[model samples]
Target: MLFTTCIEHLRTQPIWFLLISSLGFFTILKKSATFLNWVFITFIRDPKDLKRYGSWAMVTGSTDGIGKAFAYQLAKKGLNLILVSRNSSKLKSVSKEFQAEFPDTQIKTIAFDFSSDILEGVKEIEEGIKGLEIGILINNVGVSYPSAAYFHEVDEQVWMDIVRVNLEGTTWVSRAVLPGMLQRKRGAIVNIGSGAAIVVPSHPLYTTYAATKSYIDQLSRCLHVEYKHCGIDVQCQVPLYVATKMASDIASIKRSSLFVPSPDDYAEAAIRHIGYEARCTPYWSHWVQWCFAGLLPEAILDSWRLSIGINRRQGKLLIP
Candidate 1:
């Protein structure tokens, strides 16, 4: 009789009853196994399992920036390298440097430009890695707008280059490498993405660049779903800002900070997360930023992004 009376009383106060129930549900979720596993991976997980993907790791745009950093880190783990870049001289220089530092690890170079004929370059990549057991493919070759600009203001050539380098390069390179992964049934593909595509509520100024990057994110998700059962892992690594030549225009991004990491620092964290998260911010600080930013409504975030875009165009001081 008492239990029935208590239930009847709670039902009478619907709002309070619902609030209490919702709190209890959330509390349970906080302590669940799924939550604990997520916490473990987001905080403490390491890259000890990367070798299961294969023996050779190929990195595009590897002569400099994030691509170079990934190449060096993979070599540190004793993985052979296929370093692809636009500059053959730089490729030889970087390959020689890797050979000198990591004498035990084998290194190959493929000079290809993402802004040019991506199909020809992909054919070269396919021919170069023939008969080699490729375990990991880093689809890191990408180009951004020279500066933030309205869609109409961007030159036709610039638009083509952005799409060609970022979207076409990622697609064809992954296509060329995926068959090898399928044959082995054990490989990993890490496609470099930007927060402009995956994290931000809106990217106002760099329209085409963001669109290309968004394509990469979607490609990663679809491929991950399709290949996961076959022992292959596909991940899109979304990063906000790093101290790289491409991002050097903004004074704020010129120096490496905790939030804007150096290429090597970001890649070190990113490589550890290859097979773990389908879309990851990689840097812990960026994750914190994402959490805080998520609290705002999309309209507010989009408005703020618009303001930043305006400020950048007007040559005014703005926080990235």
Candidate 2:
């Protein structure tokens, strides 16, 4: 009855009726399209055959967290693995674990610290992959603040380490691996990004960390455009929060939930998104968070994010 009355009143004002109807129709259409695209990409679209890019997939920071998960996923797909991390002992253990599970998959480990001597580390990677076909590169190594604090309250060395490991490290590694991909005219480079940079307006306490990830998102866009014709797919995968050591220590997310996925669970979704969009939050739950964040005003988001950081600094549990 209300709907019929509304239609009748609208019909009496033809101009108003047409204008409102057009707006409503477009809004619904746009939302429907977005929903369908999300469904297709999240569930229906098939993952690329990773072997087509090359035989070996190189992952940075691969001894633990998302990088380790990616290494395992790639190996399961029959791709040779090149695991890079700063700890040689952890690398050896991870390599042995992978070998035990995937005996047929070849594994190589590189112990190079991204926070120190990046040029030497890049050289090590270049030399290590010499004459080896590297089809995919997962630039997943990054650093963040131990906990939320004001930018000035943080030590200079801490922010410097974050920049070195997050920005410079990604840049140098991609430069080292790009030549090989260019020569082959086919490759995929997936940079693991964060929601702090892409989804929210401001991440106040973790300013340096957010800025570095913003760089990753921009670099991925430019690189994708630059090398798409050459058969190279560059993507920045933005994830909200994975139940990793970083989240445990820094974000204080002790348990995985609908919003915070386990590293392995996140990686399984992430692999399905490679070689598609230049930027994506591969996990469906993260995508939903991104959408909701988009609906709020920037000022609201800014205040909310700042409050969360402040609460954390005050020794309050924000997640639970």
Error of 1 at 307 (Å): 1.1
Pairs with steric clashes in candidate 2: none
Point to the candidate with the largest lDDT. Answer: 2
lDDT of 2 by residue, 222-263 (tens): 999999999999999999999998998777889899889999
Q: Which stretches of model 2 miss by more than 4 angstroms?
A: 1-12
RMSD of each: 3.1, 2.4
TM-scores, all models, native as reference: 0.90, 0.96
**Tens digits of per-residue lDDT for model 1, 122-237:** 88999999998889999998887777789999999999999999998899988888888899888999999998886787799888988999999999999999999988899999
